[model samples]
Target chain A: MSLIAVVDYGMGNLRSVDKALEHVARDGQEVRITSSADEILAADRVVFPGQGAARDCMRELESRKLIEPVMQAAKEKPFLGICMGLQVLLAHSEENDGVDCMGLYPGNVRFFGKVLNQDDPAEPLKIPHMGWNNVNQTIDHPLWQGITDGSRFYFVHSYYVDPEERSIIAGETTYGIGFTSAIACDNVFAVQFHPEKSATDGLKLLENFTHWDGK
Target chain B: MSLAKRIIPCLDVDNGRVVKGVQFVDIRDAGDPVEVARRYDEEGADEITFLDITASSDNRDTIVHVVEHVAEEVFIPLTVGGGIRKIEDVRTMLNAGADKVAINTAAVFNPEFVKEATDRVGSQCIVVAIDAKQVSAEGEPLRWEIFTHGGRKPTGLDAVEWARKMVDYGAGEILLTSMDRDGTKIGFDIPLTHAIAEAVSVPVIASGGVGNLEHLAEGIIDGMADAVLAASIFHFGEFTVHEAKQHMAKRGIEVRL
Candidate 1:
């Protein structure tokens, strides 16, 4: 089994995802979190986990000289983006420093400013959308393999993804309204929810990613 | 869409060292500020603040050096304060790669300094940090007196009123630290936080008195703070950033996972 590389850009949650990958992968399958571009390119699978703003995360990648390598890896290997990681895969984000992103997927990440009710609010559904919420898989994809519909996973973000192509959506979750919760196009797969914090169901999703053979 | 509650880690640094001391105790030693900062960045900290605790603002060069190192090493936004006196000081810090420069003593000493710095650096880059202590009486004004020089001197300025003036002068954000609970770990000063939050249209970051995850959650949910800042809990490794986010999520505070 080829080792999985978790890209480290000096910003984001690196350890929990590393541990979660270890927890799900079969014996002898290894996962390493690295900032080295060479290791990222050599790996069979790459997981880009981000915990900061979209622009800052991209700046870190550029500062480390890993943008080209990461973009190339997205094309060559099975790539996964978690949380803000998923958002940066798009053409651009509204929260960006007015810079273009990796453009691995054809979509734009935007804040849900229109949906926020002026009155009678559910006090908890404030910005950062941090918590465990259920997702309904909208498209058939291997990343969601063995995971059923309405399965709760961890989500923490203020922005939502709206793909230019509706066919790319793999899952949907409801906050103030149902938005695209996950995306898959070709070899690229991304989820707005955090599988690392999704508990048993999350581990199962990781297992599916480890064994997926689809192109 | 609800605004995302940010998870920020604060570092109290003195003489190029990270130290945690209450009003009257031997300061507990922490490790290198850079190394600790790197770890937090990797663990997914939304932002980091470096508060220089020493009294003097003379070592502007040293502050620049620290900012350069942190910028080269860490990816998230860095906010540094303590002894920042003038627009030139703000320029020096920002040129050294600090995303935001916080001001306390200078803002209190010369209220116009806040306006001048904000104009020079742009309102978004200028942050007015306030240290407050709650008053004793009821039916009287519930005043939050501003403290300066690392909580050593009282400015005779009401925190709420100061906050209003700072906003009027074009400050984009406020960093409010409570001296009464600076090292107590009891919890954040919620009433004070709400008052300030209510008083200002700009974002308010509640600093001091965060002992555990519950304190952080309460600061955001009940206190209405835009962000919660703490030093001991994060510095001593009481909880990982991920664990805190998990706890906050459980309590219904929006966090980045």
Candidate 2:
């Protein structure tokens, strides 16, 4: 039996993510939401998800003693990150002034800034870029098995990830400027959008994660 | 690709069942809110809004149950509103799998509650619902006035001014509904929606009075709404979400399709 642990450090809505995973979990598969190190370490896979400011997220992870287990899990197993989960995996984030994050991925999370484009200053880019937007698949990976390119994914964040290595970028999206929407390197895969809230394509991604062999 | 304009279907739920009414009266049962939401999800609805119209303490659990059921099957953003009076109510809805909570009466009564709720949950998940009615007093320029308690009580606050204030207080989005155009089905109140959308930097969802696919387009094109939210046009089989998206797309509007 495969057990997937959804890391819970008391941030973001874990219920919806857990329920979405459970809906896609197949035979001999189980999903658990836990902050317990043992549960996370023993699990076959891990899904790190979060919302709110990066500073507060990092603080909560440190307070709950989840920083080590989460870092270790990302290194050891097939890992998936969503939203804040993706941002925190980077070296640092511009949210809450600035916050240091786990250095698993070489990148810096940057704010979208006040203006989308300085040259064409028509619409002042809205912060927390909310709603559905298309994600352009950048590379062919097992995780992109059933989902098509240019499929719309739900995103709600003021900041976006700028990976140091562009090769690891699995998907790119535009919301004023083209930004890294998803990244992949070895067994670690993360997306800026909320697949759990992305409907069909999202469910398919979660289902693929369950069957992925961490290649 | 440009950011796709959203098409949201709103379900007014009571006792776990989806209901629809004109101006909060002449109510009729639509179906189970969860079932309706699931169908909309399958039909490619950009988002879903489940408003608990009952507003009774006893029905709180039922609303939560409905939200849970919808969230379980529908893997899309869900915004739950109606009777959200406090921080606890917002917490309850978000905990039940709702991505956002819309506050109307509570925000009008206690404006500080908007700031406090946004501070606690982040503005991205806090939506301020403004029910506005066009008021033109003799000798004064026409302006939209904010209304509360399902548009029954009017507040002196200007709709555009209140929208700007809500954004300043940390509201991420504004759900603007026009009382005069709500159930009339003629179209959205473009001027009122345009006023609020232009006033606030955040996205504004134009709700109420969607008669056809063209009306939905007008909400986005004419009214400049970030999203168009409808009820009867979708719930009563007048149009599917796909059709509306197609119409919008043909009109050169960016949509998911």
Candidate 3:
């Protein structure tokens, strides 16, 4: 049975995440919540849940000695990061007080900042794109296995990951402005929106992840 | 772009006890509000609304207790109501860590209270609550009337018209509760919820009448509400948040599963 390790860095909705994973894995896979680096390294798959800031998350991961294992797992095994977990998969974040991150993807997390051209009719919207938003599918990914293109997902973040490579972007969502909402490269996959919270399509995504054939 | 429907959990507190049921009927005692709040927060609830059902219109101490407990333990945005009337009440709740304040009877009695609260605390912090009950047909009554004071008093106000007026007065959100369907497990008042959602430009949270995950999906898909709030289904463990979100995800609702 494929063992799924839900990485617990002491800052996530572990119960809900655990429940969703258990619900989706129909093959009787073992799902364990662990703050252990070795357990994560030994697992066949790992899921990273994000709830707070990128800085704290990265620090906690570092403090737990999980950075290398996480990077190794992302490179050699399937890795799923949700929300702020998705944001730190990038190089840096403006929200992190200019902290450098895992650099899993070549992108920087940025806020919409202040609107400079409101009367100019072309001003981009500012941060904290709270509430539900529609995600425009940009590429084919197994995690989005059952979800249709342009399916809606619940989003509550003020910043987004602006990936340097457009080909890696899996989906996009519009706020006051449109940005990459989901991304993937090799064994690494992440979404700015919580698929765990995205409803039926979200569950189906989790189901697909459990059955993913990504190598 | 069409917005996603949010599934929220409502906590009704009476003397620090988190209680659940329809129209406060068949009350099942849940745990402490703080503990319940922590669980919901752990479940990834989009937002949480705590109704101080017992606090009087003049008492501020109870509200403060509820606020302090939640703010100290829970991390999600909180909406606290009950006994809130003045601008200072709004300030106190916000300062106590509530992201928003829900004003029901007060806003209806004085519509300008909504405007003043919005102006003072910013429109984002003001939520106008409408507890609506379907009046009897024929000689019964023509439409849904607003009920206040924990459903103890009926204001005889039209639910739809009042919602529109409140929105116009700058209320940022609407927490519309169906007194009749609450705790009934019959499901949400979809047509009524849809009407209110369509009538206002702001977000509408459909409360009361949620028995199962399907009920929640219906509230979002058919009711056209931005969110759905229920107490019993969540509090009693009939369905955990993950299970509910999974069911919704399978039904194609956008929730954080």
Candidate 4:
């Protein structure tokens, strides 16, 4: 029986994430929403899901004493990050002036403030970029199993991750400009959209994660 | 991919069962909220909204149960409205698996509640539902007035002005429903929706008066709504969510089909 711990550092709605994991869990598989570092480290897999400001997310992770455990889990186990969870793994973020993150991936998170469609520059895209958008898979990864190449997922964030290593980007989506939508390297898989709220394809992705091994 | 307009199916619930009514009167039973929500999720609805029409003290628990049941099966953003009076109420809805909560009466009674809830839970989850009706006088220009209690009473607050104020108070999205147009299915109050959409920086969901796919498209193209919300059109099976999306896609509106 594999245990999947959804790391909750008192930010975002962790319940829906937990519920989605529970829905896909098999007979012996267990999903737990935990903030405890020990529980997170002991789990067979870790799912880090977060939303809110980058500075606040950093503060909560530090205050809850989860920084080391999260870093270790990303390296040791099959780790999945969602939205702000993906952003906090970066080196720095442009949110709230500028905030230093975990530096798990060598990149910076950028704000899409003036992102205008190339076709129509007069009509500027909205901030927060809230809605379902297509994610074009860039590289073959275990998490992309069963999911289509250009499946749409629900995204609700103003910032997008700019990873240094292009080879690690598993998926890319366009929102006025092309941006990295999903990143994968080793055991780590992170997405800018909410798979829990992405419907059929999203559920398939979560189901894939439950069976994914840290290869 | 960024600016795809949304098609949302709204479930107006009374007690634990989903119900449909005309102008908030003569309510007719639809089905179980959980079952309906699941079907919509499978049907590819962009989002699902639940409004507890009979928001009594006792039925609150039932709504919570409905939210939990739907959230378990349906993996989409769920917005719950009705009977939400305080921040604690918003917390209860969110804890019950609602991604966002819509506030109407309480927000008008105490405008600061919007800021307070937004500050605590973040604006992404706080939605301000404005039930508006166009009001005119001899000297004054046409203005939409905010209504409450299922559009039974007016608060005298200008809808366009209130929408801006709510956004300034940290409301992430605005659900603007026209009292005169709701349940009529003539089409959304385009002028009212256009005014609010232009006034607010945040996304505005055009609710009320959607009869067909064309009306839904009109909400996006003409009303300038970021999302088009309809009840009877989707609930009564007049148009499937997929069909509506296909129609929108053909009409040059980007939609996930």
Taking all chains together, each candidate's TM-score versus the true structure is: 0.57, 0.95, 0.56, 0.94
- lDDT string, candidate 2, A1-215, tens digits: 88999999988789989999999999899999999989998999999999988998999999989999999988888999999999999999988888999988888999886446362444555667888888999999999998988888999998999989989999999987899999998889999999899888998999999988889
TM-score of chain A, model number 2: 0.96
- Give candidate 4's error at residue B59 in angstroms: 2.4
Residues B33-117 of candidate 3 have per-residue lDDT tens digits of 7767767767777678888877554554776777766765554567888878788878777766576789988897899999987
Measured with C-alpha atoms, the lDDT of residue A12 in candidate 3 is 45
At residue B22, candidate 4 shows an lDDT of 20
- Clashes within 3 Å, all models in order: 6, 0, 16, 0
Query: In model 2, what are the clashing residue pairs, if there are any?
Result: none
Fill in the DockQ of model 3.
Answer: 0.11
lDDT at A140, model 2: 96
- lDDT for each residue of candidate 4 in A84-200, tens digit (9 for 90 to 100): 999999999998999999999888899887454333533446556888999999988888988889889999888899999888899999987999999999999999999999988
Rate residue B7 of model 3 by lDDT: 70
**Interface RMSD (Å) of candidate 3:** 8.5
lDDT of 3 by residue, A141-185 (tens): 777777878876656566789988888888888665678898888
lDDT of 2 at A93: 92
lDDT of 4 at A12: 80
Candidate 1 true-interface contact recovery: 0.00
List of chain A TM-scores, every candidate = 0.93, 0.96, 0.91, 0.97
Residue-level error in angstroms, candidate 4, position A197: 0.7
Range of the 10 consecutive residues with the lowest summed lDDT in candidate 3 chain A: A119-128
Candidate 2 stretches greater than 4 Å from native? A115-121, B21-30, B137-140
